[model samples]
Target: MPVAIRSGVAEPVWFVLTAIVFLVLLRRGQRRATPAAVLVTGAIVVAGSLLLPFVLPPVADDPGTGGPGIDGAVNPLINLGDDLRQGGDVPALTYTTSSTQGVYLRLATLDKFDGRQWEPADIDPARTHDVAKFPAPTGLTSAVKRRTLKASVQVDDISGRWLPVPYPASRITGVDDDWKWVAGGLTVRSRSTSASGQHYTASFLDLKPDLAQLRAATPSPVGMPLDVSVPTGMPAIIAQTALRVTANATTEYDKAVALQDYFQSDGGFTYSETAPVDQHYDGSGADIIAQFLQKKAGYCVHFSSAMAIMARTLGIPARVVVGFQPGTPASVNDKRVFQVSSHDLHAWPELYFAGIGWLRFEPTPGRGVLPTYSDPQAVDDAINQGGGTASPGATASAGPSSSASDPGGASAAPSASAGAATATDRADATPWIVLIVLLVAIALLFTPAAIRAAQRARRMRAVARGRDPAGNAWAELRDTARDNGWAAPDTQTPREFAERLTVTLASSAARIDGLRRGVETTAYARAPGPIRVEDLRSVVKAIGASTSGRDRVRAVLLPPSLVARVRGDEE
Candidate 1:
């Protein structure tokens, strides 16, 4: 079987595999005394390990029903993102929901972005108490007419520490005592019990709010605010894309729906596990989100991560859910059981709206059904006006909900009678404005380097044109030496500088002598001769070779002479 490097085990396994390869190479190197063998072996080892995870042998060719055997050391929760992104065709879990329509079973929510990765703000296993009910879905009440969904899940081959459950799970029964409620993502987790072979029933509330009602709901500015601040150094394309996609959207709800439509429908994003397109974002994380948007192809992780980040860029609190989608249905003794395989492992984005709570949206195509309320033509204007019966899925039965809702709801949607319009507009503009400011700040960061490079180029051109070329070349050499920590003053004569260089760059004495003679003739001889470009090049190359790699790099990048000259010009 091709080694399908499990996400959690990839690092340690790579280390061990590499060490073994090294030891074998070391033994051979000692016996043969051929250093070339070691270098070739090292390259092979690196290439092999990197390509190992992606290799799919005949056995792996069909990852049907279950994943590779699980070792207790791997926590599937943390590795879920990688697993789903890898697009393995293994079994994850199986479940039977009372409703025929498939629902997304969430495992966890990631919140923080440190430019490169998205991780949960905190995971304190101690915070989970053995509670029967979570405080009722934040905004759900008798008024919302919530419907309850019951699901029975059995782990097949996947072994993860976290139990997958639908959002706002009201209760869970029939599981080991180890399961605890985690609040960050409103998920149930257990470190002691792997999800494999475990069975449990979860009851979650399905809140069905009409599109107009959702569009009208104003997210609170305080108390678990949905407005997430974008981190610094994030790619500017994220915010720019978010704004451009939702430019005509008048409400946060509309902007979110617009984004979903763009990704899932009109956006022309292709669904692929291997990122059929090499340029597509292949489930990396926050930093790669911009690339994901541009490439428009990837598996669930790419779709979910991109949508969530875009939502955040629009100042909406959004999160990516790592979970399994409702899978193929099978009949077991008259009971409709959904057989969720590892192949069904999926992710989607959820955006929080005040009054309505966290609403899920399906941005990945070919994975799950899009909610009906998201469809504009299906939305009844009378329903949004609170006159018609609840929207198609509002009754909360276990069936695929229709995405029928006001398509242009945001366009004609009325704002709250008070100061809502101004506040909403400001909220919508904050992300773009912040992005603009950040872009300006980033350009300023490289301003000094850019100025130094220009100054160096200008002076080099002047010297090449024979404007006291030998003297200028000598001056350039002295400045380079000074920048690299050698003390050379303008007051020194050409011969004196050459002597100093002879001591420092002992191997390049001849080159330095030639440069000194040229400078001396140009500066002092009654009849000055043009300096040879070949001689100047040789002396510069010799000086560079004499310096350490670190100093040479710094001299080229932040040449002190050019920087000083630029500063002098500024002064």
Candidate 2:
């Protein structure tokens, strides 16, 4: 998940809390080196930082309500339907294309279905640095009229580590060296740089398959191995719906076209940002599809996930694509550019047909461009049956509810004024935002122990710098024993402690006496004796060797002395 930086007074609040924790820790360390105050104060800082975003209300650069799974990856992005529904008209990214048609740059292709949501499968580790002349499309050939286009993209505040690139990109320029080509999805991703602030130009070839050619294409069994696996426990309604909808269609392409028409047209489903009340499938995967089937109302995530799952259920290899829709057109330097906003963030289903390879479908209502090859008769039938036009932006309220007055309507023109997230939009992002906070809290809980270990290491290093390294090493070992529930009383003299060690740990008696003699010589003599490193290790090893296996393990893992010091509950 991307860390959203919203402009608010939360920054000042964060600084104040951090300062308080540091000051409290410093004061406590000076007194008794207790970590209780530090731990409590640090926990507060972590929790407060997480909650402040929600409490302060979203400001500029606010990442609108995240749907489910959207990252910066070029493949395997999932759970974006909810974000599509919940987002306000925030800017996502902008692009300038050589062609008149809007270009849909893909983020990731999610193929793995874990019953709850769709995710990307493991990709080949072999990465290509060069983006010039990628592997050719599997089945596309010279017969198809391939349109070559150059597109320059500029990312705004979008988060995630993946770079967005069009399918079958031939060349890319101006990308950082960290970017790598992932073969399975044919998308580019960065090893470090995020999608935000990315500026690059991509050269891609778009093969527009004719409706007839797609319809005639057969299903290849080999290609089906990628994304055609459907979970066994998938709702029966999904399979039944796919069967029922495509019953009249004969070819694989037509079956796909039929499913598209069923969802976008004849199905009477409306485009809305909110999920239906009676249907509770807000999460992803098979269960969400079941709820989507019954409700028939959701944003793009629901529609895309459902269609992809349905295609797989019908034995067609399908995957969901997460990316920005070709945004609204704008003129810059007399060239046309598409301004994709956060609201333009979308997900759609793509199905693979043999010979034609993978082709995209627009099942998401009022959200994406309709594919060029949808069956004309079926599309008209859908329109006649109260299904709207194939336009991505249908005329509906700009919020959560849907409007059926104009389905299959023309794409809604992007508004010039659409910018910052509203109060309502900020409110929608609250739950997921809180989840991020809780994760931070879990990480912060171990802060005190980590700090104490670091301090002990520093102290040990400082002690080693003195003339009596052996004596200091002995003292460290004694403290270690004390922390791990062994006896290391301050009242015992060095010789007395050595005698006690000989009795308690019989095997280490000679080494313990040697260490004690060194300590006594360093303390009593004006000129300290030279230190031997092995004397300290010899005694420490003997002590460890004498303890039971369970006690030795406990001493290393659960340092009772450190815990007692932190709690100011020394025993």
Candidate 3:
């Protein structure tokens, strides 16, 4: 480790990672022409972006009504959803006093699957559900003032073989196997093994000749292999863009430097959770590149893609690097918190310099050197700032519920309001404004009779499972059908529930039957437990698959008005 950073240039791991990332992107590009493939890709990205995080305790960065106030004091990042799991009821959710708790807001931990997807980190039958450990002491490294910046890390997972931490990890911690640090700024295992986020501490030693001095020196003749070619359609754009951005730079390093600057300039780049994905269809990698340029938006993947494509266009080989960014050093007693957010998700390009293995270029905005905690003052902001409501489109929860006429009964039913944006106040007099909208809403509103009459049709479903015939379940089932444009009979029996399922939603019949049967079985068998999770899974899936299921998904995903026609049938 000491010998590696003698020259403040990048380590060789930079090129290897770039090559691997490029290969993955190129393969994806090869099949981009197919719509089906592109859609699948988009779907995967979306699902991964959404579903996976929730199954486990929600990751801090996982989207909800989160922001820099209210729950900010609790630092949800400290515990795996302790605040949300406790439903904001836990005292931990409140922080009257400023407590810099030593909790690790896990910057990134993929227990399931490899580098991508919701695949379980491993299918180890004997694997513990939860482990009683932290990054092993050896795994943890420290950047002691002098002797050495000991960075320790542990790889506790077994699904994927990829390492943790982002590029430019100047020094490593906790890597104590036969493995040694590589020039690419990472440690490598001879074979793939899911490793833990080893705990190690290290400091960016003040090597005499820093970046400038090293860049001035010639790069060593380390063999750089083109493990992966640029995805198709990428080459042309890469060349053109590179020429436009770096034509002035006489040397490769100079060109790389200018491109880095442009990204930070008027590129409009950002670390957004709202980036688009081609989950289902396969678009040419070139098309993906084109979309990026036109849209000029996305997560790290996009930024890295654009940079590499542009660099290659100018005849300079470049690759993207994916790793955790440098974390701010913090010492905690109870738990070492490493809070990572959607903001922490980043991507950057590594341009190959003749003598400098690969220099890092942060194409993604809000990246590079950042704080360990997401704006420590955010807690104080929430504290000093009294209660306010949050309205839609407000950054996370700007405040509280502000007014009535919350569009579509959005706030009609009081929710917990933990993350409500600064909503329009109830008395924020919008007399004429409310009057006009109310008139419009009234013109489109249904009478109370209509609401009751509709509810009466899906008469109380009394499953034998000791469920109340006319309870929340009944209402829920009825609403589910109505949402799908299916109006169940008032006397819906288990058989009836199953029979009413339209062929379009035939797949969902099993679910209705399962729930009905389970309730019956519980009541008849006098079972002590409720529907097991496994059984509930299919029931939920069925309800989700039915016509009503489609409606529910649409209503939640898209605005209610967009699906007004479909909903009208339910009424």
The CA lDDT of each predicted structure is 0.58, 0.60, 0.35
Model 2, 1-571: lDDT tens digits are: 0122342224434554565666675775375544444555555665666565556643322132243333343222332433454545556677877655667777766666656556556433245556654676655556654656688998776666566676667788887666776655666666556667789998877565555666777755453546467777777999999889989988888888789888887899887655542344454456656877888887676777788778877888777667666667778898877777656666777777676666777787666667545644444344344332333333323322122111122211111000111112233345565566566555556554565466556645644576446556665677667745678876778877778778877777766776677777888887775555565656666666667776765555445566566566544
Cα lDDT, model 2, residue 340: 72
Quote the lDDT for 540 in model 1: 66
Q: Pick the candidate with the highest lDDT.
A: 2
Stretches > 4 Å off in candidate 1? 1-88, 139-142, 225-227, 376-571
Instruction: Rank the models by lDDT, top first.
Output: 2, 1, 3
RMSD after CA superposition, every candidate: 15.1, 16.0, 25.2
Better of 1 and 3 by lDDT: 1
Q: TM-scores of all models?
A: 0.55, 0.56, 0.36
TM-score winner: 2
lDDT by residue for model 1 (1-571), tens: 1222421223433554555576575765354332333433444444444345435332221122244732211112234434454535566567777654555666655555444445544344564466376655544435443567687888777555556677777799988667777655666767566666778888876555665667786644467722355678788888898899999999888888899878877789877656623543433355556777777776666677678778888888876566655566768898876766655555666777777766667777766655555655555553445323223443322222222221111101000011111122233343454355345434444444566556545657767787777756776677767667677776778788789888877777877787778777877788765566666666666777778887876665556565556345221
Model 2 lDDT at residue 429: 49
Global local distance difference test of model 2: 0.60
For TM-score, candidate 1 versus 2, the one ahead is 2
**TM accuracy, model 3:** 0.36
